[model samples]
Target: MKRIVFFLGKGGVGKTTSSAALSFYLSRNKKTTYWVSIDPAHNLSDIVHKDLHIKTQIDDFLFAEEVDVEGYLKNFLHETTNRMKEMYKYLQIVNLENMFDLLKHSPGMEEYALMYAMKEKIEENQDFEYIIVDTPPTGLMLKILSLPFSSKMWIEKLIRWRKRIISHRAAIANINPKKIDESLALTEEDDKVLKELGYQSEYVTFLIDLLSDKSKCKMVVVLNEDAMSLSESLKIKSGLNDLGLGLDFVILNKEGLGTVSNNIEKIFDLPTIRMPYLKNAMDTNTLANMGQRLAKIVE
Candidate 1:
């Protein structure tokens, strides 16, 4: 089984360290595992003490990478521009490079790019027993995680619109065969656009199904004792619930509560795992021990 785990929380909440440690702990069990950092400000390399700017083999059973989001976005946008040119011949006059520069900063592009990168990773690396992801902080993380559900609707609508256009063209051509423009006739490019849209729609559906399958995926929300942390965690919980995804655990990092634990468990509706503040300097050894403790709780 290819099990995927996501570590999520507000910034400075120790998601990167916890995810790295957990990945190492799991790898020690002789299971093939890959640790990935998708955060734009990735600290996984420093935490893991390896240069993982690209995919690197830590050992026989463990691999690591800090995903290059900009790189993926560039490639994704280039392909998208090509597709648009195929579908709309007039698009050739519009400079796509400048258009993409603006589009890169658009609302949903980053999230969709990250989602597409994830889909590529999962499909390419199925031999690993576990794939652990250290996500960006709360807001972007939720958007990235929820892209499949939200994007599917838009893609489906686009598919329908394309089909209608094709049907209308066919009807016009049937009514007046002499009036049809050869260039306007349905070509291989139009067919390719339809195929590409269908593929994208199905890919998003696959992501939705994979994430909702709790047996294959787990979402770990890391929080601290601070009130702000708790509040952000609540929003994260609510958002996940709204998207019909279940939380696997609520990790209260850097503190332990005496009697307040009951309240936390009640509010989050999941078991709580408390990690003590690190009095010692953080290192591989210390993180490994912490991961051991976390494994006991999460397992």
Candidate 2:
């Protein structure tokens, strides 16, 4: 079985560093690990001191990659357009140049794009024993994490609408076939699209089950000693709980550097780990050390 782990926190809380460190530690321990950076503003390369835009093999057991969001988005849009054309014969003449532009501004487009990339990577990386993701900040990560449930709900509504359309089409055909435009008639492609949507929804549901399963998935929330970070972490914990996924643990980074207290354990009700503040710049050596600390908790 594949184990997938995520490191998420507020921006500037050292999530990338922690993720890289933990991945390094895991890989060193004979686990076939792949470290993935999914943040739009990626810093995994900088942390690992390697060019991992596509992927880089660190060793026989370790691989790393930073997803190119723009490249993935373009491919996603192209695939979507192709699917649309396949579903609608009239789409051959329709101009979608503006549709692509509109999608860039659409709400949740980035999150969906990120989710698509994640799903693809997970599917392609079945050979790896461990998959570790360095996610974006708290808010966006929440949206991406909730995609399985939200997308399933959306697909369910679409399926219902498609059934209604089919019913109306049957009624119109019985009344007068000429009254309904041939182009407006539901085609085999429409049914195919609905079937595809249902199929994808099932896959998403499986993903949700796997994620909520503690043995297969571990979600660690990284935070610092601050009220804002604490508040965000609380919200994240609540959100994951709502989705039936537990917040596995919390890592308090930069301990003893600030006046912020570590009384968060009482409120969050989860095991808390702490990393001391590193005065020097973080390189592979320091990261490995950090990873050693994280490794203890996971073990």
Indicate which candidate wins on TM-score: 1
Give all TM-scores, in the order shown. Answer: 0.90, 0.89
**TM-score, predicted candidate 2 vs. hidden true structure:** 0.89
Query: Which sections of candidate 2 miss by over 4 Å?
Result: 91-97, 180-190, 279-281, 296-298
The backbone clash count of each candidate, in order, is: 0, 0
Stretches of candidate 1 off by over 4 Å are: 90-98, 184-190, 256-262, 296-299
| Candidate 1 local lDDT, 62-163, one digit each (tens) | 899988898988898887767776666644677765766767677788888899988888777778888888999999989988889988988989988888
Q: Lowest lDDT 10-mer window, candidate 2?
A: 181-190
> Tell me, what's the RMSD of every candidate?
2.5, 2.6
